[model samples]
Target: MLIKNYRTQFTEELTSIFDEKEIESFFYIILEAFHELKRVDLVLNPNLELDTIQLLQWETVLSQLKEQKPIQYILGETEFFGLPFYVNENTLIPRPETEELVEWIIEDLKIKKFKDLKILDIGTGSGCIAITLAKNLPNASVFAIDVSEKALVTAKKNAELNEVKVTFIEKNILETEDLNQQFDIIVSNPPYVRNLEKQEIHKNVLEYEPHLALFVEDNDALLFYRKITELATKNLSKNGQLYFEINQYLGKEMVELLEKYNFENIELKKDIYGNDRMIRCVLKS
Candidate 1:
């Protein structure tokens, strides 16, 4: 079938679930993943046709999309910080907001003259943050911890794919009483979405994404943040920095929690959306 015709059929099938813009985006993503035909290729060569086997594969992908499966999971991989990562139901798919958090850390490191820096990434699903740090800052020692062994396996595979070394260990952050070594930088994109907000999430996410990595109780929304901050006070190197990708709704609360621990230079920054999406704090030297 011609690319144009297939797109029309795909769009019509998905129109009920997703709008025109979303369907278009999904179409190009799947086309590139399955056929290596990019959006530009489709525009320039509108007559490009899928062979019999290719048509079968395209139809299979379409079926999954119709069922509201995430395009990333269907492709089984995604790009983050210019590196490819394998993703599955065991992990939360890396989001662009998290990419901003990673960029913030990299930029901060560039300004600091510290050498041989040690970094820790808590709840390192898919190892996106830890692997990106190791890949970007070649001299840094990176360690990541996750509660799920299955998630850690996926994270380790991503590290291998990116060709960067990161130490991965399994530990529940809530139960983590000690971190033996001090880190020059500690960062986390912990589960900050409250259970009450689940109604606001799209069905695709609530159904396909791992809830263990995305939610906390509405009454105690800052559970992970409090735990990580407490540990940072004890384990963070003097003058070390702490970073978090936080819920925009609780920016003030997050900053207050850090301040209660005597974290200095606490700054809450907005993401591209102008919502409070990230925070940075420094430990007293």
Candidate 2:
């Protein structure tokens, strides 16, 4: 069948669930992934056709999109920090804001010219943070910790996929007392979403994403931050930095929490959307 005709059918089936532009984008994404065709290809060769097997592949993705499944998960892969990553239900899809967090770290460290720093990434779901850092800072040693074994498996695969060496450990951060070793930088984008914020989440996320990686109790939304900060105090080297992708609504509270731990140079940063989304501080010498 003609690819253009299939696109019309795909758009009609998902129009109620997604906007026209989104549906079109999904069509092109799937076209490239499954058929090696791009939007320009469709324009240049309007008579492009899909074989029987390719049509089945497109149909499956179309049905999944109609159910509001995220396109990344439907493809079982995603790009983060300009690197390819394998993603599944076991791991949370890396977000653009988290990429911003990674960029902030890279920019700061690049200025410092730390030739050989040790970095630890807590709750490293898909090893996005740790692997990206290792890939960019070739001289740095990177370690990642995740509580879920399945998540660690995916993270390990991502580390290999990105051709970065990251030591991944499976341990619950909230239950640990000590890191046993100091790190030059400690970072995390942990579960910070409050239960009260569930209503604000879209159906695709609420229904398809991993809740274990996305949420914390409403009454204790800062649980991960508090615990990670406490660990950073003991585990970070003197003058080392601690960074967090935080709950946007709790920036002030985050500063207070970090200040209480005697960290210095605390900074709360806003994402592109102007939400207070990340924080960084220094361990006092």
Candidate 3:
């Protein structure tokens, strides 16, 4: 019942499945979210105890974690680009690599002081990218689209929660012929993982994350990228930029793909882990 006792029990129970530090970290996260109690609270009040309902909450989370469910999904929320987002089985949890992509766009456009720019986020998932951009770049009009209406519902809630206005559309990119509306920037962190690469995924992700938002056929790994590029060819404004959070193994292939599509100033960037994880290209002015 005591906070310290629960912390130790939590780590011991999850030690076989997760690292001690990770379990401790997740414990602190849940602790704060559920009880508004921080690590310092446990230290200052060593006798602090969890009530019956709170103990049950911890038990439920532990059970889900043992099944390799993601903590974000267990909590039904996550933070992206320093903003909170609601997430569920329908959406892919936004990742740090995608935050880097958003930062790159923000840094470029903030310096340019672009006015009334239009930004589109294909496969928006939790609306993290669109809402973050709208929050950061007040001058930009943000729009996001996903094939799943369920994902869009969560994305819209996230936008409202963050107090930023982003137009959310439920449309499958593969079935669409054109974007119709031209945009100064278009970004997508689509389903880039090849089916063969499932071996490389973490159990928590491969088992719990949305497969529709993560994977593509091994024989056609670039299916979403190709379709988005085709749409960009028709819909990107003159001087518009295109960005993608790409699969690390496909950097060279992505470069060739963009070249074929006539996207200039193509730049492939590495994430914090030093893997080629993002690419940006601009239309010829």
Candidate 1 residue runs with Cα over 4 Å from true position? none
lDDT of 1 by residue, 143-191 (tens): 9999999999999999999888999989998998889999999999999
How well is each residue in 1-285 modelled by candidate 2, as lDDT tens digits? 998888788888898899888887888888788867788888999998889988988888888887889999999998998999999999999999999999999999988755469999999998899999999889999999999999999999998898889999999999999999999999999999999999999999999999999999988989999999999989998779999999999999999999999999999999999999999999888
What's model 2's TM-score?
Answer: 0.98
Clashes of each: 0, 0, 0
Per-model TM-score on C-alpha atoms: 0.97, 0.98, 0.98
Error of 2 at 257 (Å): 0.4
Tens digit per residue, CA lDDT, model 3, 118-227: 99999999999999999998878999999989999999999889998999999999999998989999999999999888999999899888899999999999899999
Model 1 pairs in collision: none
Q: Write down the worst ten-residue block by lDDT for model 3.
A: 107-116
Better of 1 and 3 by TM-score: 3
* Candidate 3 segments whose C-alpha is farther than 4 A from its true place: none
